[model samples]
Target: MKKLVFIFLTLISTNLLAQRPQTEQGKGSLAFWENLTKLCGKSFEGEMINASENDQFYGKKLVMHVRTCEDGKITIPFHVGDDHSRTWVLTMEEGDVIKLKHDHRHEDGTEDRVTQYGGTSSNTGMSKVQFFPADQETTSLIPYAATNIWWITLDDTTFSYNLRRINNDSSINVKFDLTKEVDTPPTPWGWED
Candidate 1:
């Protein structure tokens, strides 16, 4: 009777443990990223506006090219003062997060004047990067709260980018409205459909 009771208790404990919820090992489940596969292969045109009053920077026009293959790429041609321009390479990461890297050189190998334009996704659902000007001290580019961080959303004929910036006081929000060309769709990759 003692051995049988012990066996029954062991079976009950095992059953309960199996029924318990299993914790995810990686970044959340795919349900958190529903229909995210549609974001790939979309070409977009947008703008990166600087709404910070403390800084003298203003708004700039930007064009983004997002390609989805095995290794996806997002190229943003950012327009600065006058003819100054740069291209930012936004790459996807683990669990669909993005990392933006800067390239101020043109195709002819000329240097453009785009400053402080590289960042990675923060844990707070925002992309955070540091700004170190020649004169001012280094600081993080804080978009207003979690809303200012922008991502690319696209459909067959329409593409939109919603960019938000959190202010220093954490009370104000700055936003930019961007639109893209509707006629042209990106050429499908050799491997992509």
Candidate 2:
């Protein structure tokens, strides 16, 4: 009976510790997420390349325009393809983590892409974001490869979306250093209504 009581107490203590959020640095204020979102309002450019030896067709060059208002309304223009034809929407998913959801949008305000995509803030508090592809199962999304890690670094004026795509377990990784463009280009490729 004494052993059973000690085991129950240990289990309860472990459960309580697990319930607590990680606060080694500070409270889970999620300041990193906010800072990353700020990159959207201005004109920025980035690239998405394949991390494979076979060379897959990923967005090579992209111009991102993140627009936001005082009322908290926001929109991010994501251009893709060689002609820069497609536009993907980036919206904030209100929660503790400040998740960003992406989807293809038409002029009529409908979804165009067959699958939805976006990313969630990492709980590790390491200033990282996870990219989520719609076709992937939820269980497989968290442990995303380093290539899927779109490391966004920004200054007061300029920003860089260091998009990386990890193709294999080896060292060959495709990299795109998307620097901010001064002028905004026309609407993306598939902006038609």
* Alpha-carbon lDDT, every model: 0.40, 0.46
Candidate 2 residue pairs in backbone clash? 40-66, 41-66, 46-178, 85-189, 85-190, 147-164, 147-166
Candidate 1 residue lDDT tens string, 45-68: 444344565532345333343433
Model 2, 1-193: lDDT tens per residue?
Answer: 9999999999999898777654334334244445546555566665443344354434355566664423323455555434443343433345443344445556555556432444454533333433433223322543444235344443454444434445554332222233534466565544431
After the best TM-score superposition of candidate 1, give how far the Cα of residue 169 lies from its true spot, in angstroms. Answer: 8.4
TM-scores for every candidate against the unseen true structure: 0.38, 0.48
Q: Supply every candidate's count of residue pairs whose N, Cα or C atoms clash at under 3 angstroms.
A: 4, 7
| Most lDDT-accurate candidate | 2
Worst 10 residues of 2 by lDDT: 130-139
Which runs of model 2 end up more than 4 angstroms from their true locations?
1-30, 37-40, 48-60, 69-73, 81-95, 106-110, 122-180, 188-193
Q: After superposition, how far is residue 157 of candidate 1 from its true place, in Å?
A: 11
Alpha-carbon shift of residue 129 in model 2 (angstroms): 5.4
